[model samples]
Target: MKTKILFLLSIIVLGTTSTLKAQKLKKFGSSIEKKIGPKTIKVPYTDVVSYLGYAAPGNEDEVKDGKKFYYIYVWVPAVAPELGVRMMSPVGKAKTKNPIKSEAYTKNAKSKDYFDTYITLERSDIISADNISQDAVDSANWVILERNDDSGEMPKQPSGSSYNSLLRYKSDINDPLKALTVGLYRIGFTTYKTGEVKGTFLAEVAAPVKLPGVVMAKTIADLKAGMSK
Candidate 1:
């Protein structure tokens, strides 16, 4: 009888686990559909303008000099682009100026009007664009931005500008999403600089395109699993 009881308990646990996994995937599917697709949101136009700058990892010098900082663009569309009305920041910044072949990147990024060349505006802000840019109508990979101030101490050190751009974008876009819907996304970060670089990551996305909670959980799980293995 004890063995039979143990078997029954095992069956119950399996049933429960299976049910939970199905629910999780269902939730993930619903969330992904919302996020991985195109969408829009309502935001103070000022905040939208800030999204134009790319994400930064909040700077001591920026704060010291009083340059409002930002980067990292995530479109957690409340009702989404067609679903509802929302303001959009239309340009994307690039770590390199390759996509717009006609535009050339100048030697002095610090001294010149960088945005005029490297940064571009996309007609479309959707993921299929392959790169991020300044405008919504362009490619997904073109992250179009310039230092808020050319003179302030460099943000997130000199090497990690793209990463900072991603960060700023993510932080800026995420804030408005907290208010509504099962808002969805297809989020990522990549960066560029003027010169040839190796062993230098222009930028990297923080990971997991959907909910921050999901990203955090997966991160923790990956960490523990890595430590154990």
Candidate 2:
């Protein structure tokens, strides 16, 4: 009788575990649909044009190896032909008296610093409805801008900018989203000329609303095992 009772208890525990897992999986799926699903935006450069944007949900306040970070999605337009956008960050204050010796100082610094910057696109060959492929979209470049020391806002005039450059997401271990960190970032067109016509948009990195895809996948697997038992 005791052996039979033990067996029954084990079965009950297994069943409970499975039910909980499945519930978590469903919740994750719903969250993804709401946050990272397909989105359409009008490419700002053209008077009237549209492009699809796809992004993955990010995690909030993720702690690893004694470091804190917040992951957020950075998106790129699918139909941008000749124009490319990148992320920028402010040049840190110079610590050395000689500007040339300062690591933060650069040769390509902009003229006047604007507290609030604008991003615009220009010199485009043409605008069309040609949809960019998933592979191309996945491989597109993204920017990571550092947050201001005093505020969450990104610096208006970046001392330096990244255009058509590779980001951490490209080399993330297993997932690109893992490369995102807590900070303020800018999304704007890449231009050769410093004062060329352009527009800028600010992206604030914060806590995520849902679990990442990897976590959700593990939860679903656990749910399956529990249900099978």
Estimate, for each residue in 168-193, the C-alpha lDDT of model 2 and write its tens digit: 11213344332332211222322233
lDDT of each residue in 55-86, candidate 1, tens digit only: 22332111212333122233332222211111
Candidate 1 to truth, TM: 0.19
Stretches of candidate 2 off by over 4 Å are: 1-88, 93-153, 156-229
lDDT of 1 at 15: 72
Cα TM-score per model:
0.19, 0.17
- Report the Cα lDDT for residue 77, model 1: 27
RMSD of each: 20.6, 23.9
